[model samples]
Target: MSESSDLVMPDAADSERAAEAALRPRHLEDFVGQPVVREQLSLVLEAAISRGNVPDHVLLSGPPGLGKTTLSMIIANEVGGSLRLTSGPAIQKPGDLAAVLSSLQEGDILFIDEIHRLARTAEEMLYLAMEDFRVDVMVGKGPGATSIPLPLPPFTVVGATTRAGLLPAPLRDRFGFTGHLEYYDDDELATIVVRNAVKLGADLTQDAANEIASRSRGTPRIANRLLRRVQDWAQVKGNGKLDLSAARAALDVFEVDQRGLDRLDRAVLEAVCVRFGGGPVGLTTLAVSVGEEPETVESVAEPYLVREGFLVRTPRGRAATALTWQHLGMAPPEQSDTLFT
Candidate 1:
């Protein structure tokens, strides 16, 4: 069992979001990691500035907490444009999206996070808007409906999605540039932790930063969140300094393992290794066993587990790897072919 509750999830809560906002780098140069993305984006912004025109629409695709939102905000800042934030789930209807688009000024940026989830109608409306800078707004319903074309000011759409493959080809084609962000490496994550810790007023030592980074699962958001938790521990229990000892103690208190597994992560592994006899269990069954939604299991826990070689998706279902049993401190069952079924 994990030493703490699932409420101590890696997902940023409101407070953590406030910390993230404050810690976000305003310029591309200040942003750490994703060197390839940063360089390409810099060229795009520079070319637009030289031409004295709004840059082309950008699509940023990556896993959650990889700085897509930060990049979008940076794009607006570099271009000297105001950013209007919205999400695919927010635009329930075409009118909802139209309302947002109509409000944009020349040089303004509309950042749509989770854009792959946009409704079909909203997506079609966006197709026209992106290419022609106009939308045919339907004013009436039924046979009396009228398509009144509304010309929008020239602006840029920065779409961020965790599932870029889910985007339709037509919609994907509309974007001028797509920057796929990769996970941060250990050294890069350590730098990010050290830099952000200073902004948060925590006296984090280099070794402590490295410790946090090693356990961060190559994600900056988790690194910062853990640092904040360590900061809390240091201020209250330790001598108000984030050193190696304080870092390890704080992480233990928060129930984040050395590999960055939290309560939810452990739950999935335990379900597979213990209850299901090392799995080949269906996703729904696995989710039910862990008392979490299927989406939570598939999206939140499955990715990292599979990526780290602890879980594998088989035709039969999800099976546990040898590493999973070892991670759970359980004896590996007999080498059975069924485990791979």
Candidate 2:
């Protein structure tokens, strides 16, 4: 699955990270989409800045490749706080979180990506710190352990998660403001593609930008990454012009379809339809058939497939829609008991 770099998930490679860093918007005004969240977040930051106090903890939830991390950085910038980046996996215990929290400089913003994955004990520790700016530290183990309450200066915690429902109610309730980010529309992604293309010094035409946007799977990170790929093709194969033709050729070379289905996505559909006879196949079976982790197939491939009407999820499992067969250029299978409405 990692071989399919265009699978709509954020790439963890250093090169991709460097590109994202270079192209990320530094200020709230420069953020490309999510108008409602932008407006509300701006108001919160403005009010907090005016009041000379740290803003309330912010919770941002969305799927990957959306702007949660970017928005968190914008929050830190707006609040005039240094951004401390970490992830839920990195904080394995209460002590791990304590080390991070105790080092805060009053106005610093600690951004926890994948916050929902935090250990329950660490989450319990966070509840007290977020609410009262204090943590009770244990000085010893067993019977000799002494609980020492430590007071902390006011700070902000910006927690970003792909699955908001997994967060505990106590931790979730502590966030004064929560913003849910949605996928970018084609027009918004088109604007972002064009803007980032210019930033990357590409001569991307408007139609080329639109083409990338349509195939970007409604994510700004995908749009920007595809623009970079198109730029590479333009430089190497298209006489240095990022025209519509170059963009189309590059996308075709990369095997991204008109509907943004990549090789993995199509493989999932092909397995369900051709192998399982338009399946109510279980997810593990589907992943095994397609040679992917269940998590990868579910998160990276299934969401867009389900969202775009190419696949359907049911109590039984996954089933292909009529469109999936047509997209695969195959005759529709006769309705079977496996099919669900």
Predicted candidate 2 versus true structure: per-residue lDDT over 1-341, tens digit per residue: 67577555555576677888888888999998899999999999999999999998999998899999998888888878999999999999999999999999999999999999999999999999999999999998999999999999899999999999999999899999999999999999998888888888888899999999999999988888789899988888889999999999999999998999899999999999889998889999999999999999988999899998898898999998888888999876566644443
| Native-referenced Cα lDDT, model 1 | 0.92
Q: Please give the lDDT score at residue 33 for candidate 1.
A: 89
TM-score of each: 0.93, 0.93
lDDT of each: 0.92, 0.91
Model 2: how far is 310 from its true place, Å? Answer: 0.8
The residue pairs found clashing in candidate 2 are none
Which runs of model 2 end up more than 4 angstroms from their true locations?
1-15, 335-341
Model 1 bad stretches (over 4 Å): 1-17, 338-341
Task: Identify the candidate with maximal TM-score.
Answer: 2
Least lDDT summed over 10 consecutive residues: which range in candidate 2? Answer: 332-341
Q: Tens digits of per-residue lDDT for model 1 on 22-50? A: 99999999999898999999999999999
Candidate 1 global TM-score: 0.93
| Deviation (Å) of 189 in candidate 2 | 0.3
